[model samples]
Target: MESGFGTRRRTRLFDDLLALFLAEGFSQFTLDDIAAALHCSKSTLYTLAASKDDLVRRVTVHFFKRATAAVETTLSRNDDPRERVAAYLTAVGAELAVASEVFMADLNAFPPAREVYEANTAAAATRVRQLIEEGVDAGAFRAVNASFAGDLIATMMVRIQQRDVGKATGLSDAEAYTELATLLTNGLRT
Candidate 1:
């Protein structure tokens, strides 16, 4: 059985690992490099994941899970449909702003990590769909096909996540999300 202190240490180490990955992409780090960077032993790092790729995937999951919770918390604070939609998008952007461009590029390049992002994007798209439906129901938005709009937004979001929008428009992911929120809210307004 693990002691409470052991659990806390592991949690702190995981937090540190995530911070490091967010600041500097994980693509270039070896197990030894990671241990050195985190001031932990190789065996200690192994406790987190069996391999570097596994650790990367785990950290990616942690990042998205935390971001999702924060976005939901932000959304809960707003009552108006328009504001709720805007808050959701803005909150997503805020959470993503912590990730460096290098980290994003690395994430896109890694298939396992990319899958996690794709799953989160799909979930977020569904959420946006529901928000649009709510707005239309509440008479705050124009009567349009909510599913279509949501699908369109999902496509744009995937493009943004894939770095295609960044390549084409010179807009960072966070900036692109902000633009999306503005355009979506304004277009939906009655």
Candidate 2:
């Protein structure tokens, strides 16, 4: 098992490295570049993460964890399934809007990050399924296969949100949320 200090140190190193990768673009960075960015030797980074692949995984996990926490907080505030779902989507939009451009750029540059990204997305879909199932049980939503519909809804919302972000569609976040809520409510209405 890792000691607390060791874990903390690794966490800090990972955070620093991730920030640098986001800022500098990961595809172009060599280990020496990372070391220079962190003001440390290459060996130090190797001590914390085995390779660049591991570093990307750790960074992707860290980012998605933060996103998941935010969604959880949004869900906890509303008991109504529709409201909770809306809040969750709004939270996601807000996150994407506020996310550093460098982060987006880096994500586009790193193909290896896709697996981690997909895993995070799947986890969010599962949460949405749980919420949908609860709503159905309470007669708030139509009786449906909560898992399948949830996955579909989650995938659609993510794609639309990404498109909006990439295109800078000029839609306000509130407008986007309202549009998504309307679409979802129509589909899920009893």
Number of clashing pairs per prediction, in order: 0, 0
Residue runs of model 2 more than 4 Å from their true location after superposition? 142-148, 157-182, 185-190
* The 10-residue segment with the lowest total lDDT in model 1: 81-90
Candidate 1 local accuracy as lDDT? 0.93
Q: lDDT per model, in order?
A: 0.93, 0.69
Candidate 1 TM-score, C-alpha based: 0.96
Scored by lDDT, the top model is: 1
lDDT of 2 by residue, 48-131 (tens): 669987777777777677777887887788878756666676676565454456566566556667566666656666766777
Alpha-carbon shift of residue 144 in model 1 (angstroms): 1.4
| Superposed model 1: Cα runs more than 4 Å off | 1-4
User: Residue 45 of model 2: what lDDT?
Assistant: 84
What is the TM-score of each predicted model, taking all chains together? 0.96, 0.76
RMSD of 2: 3.6
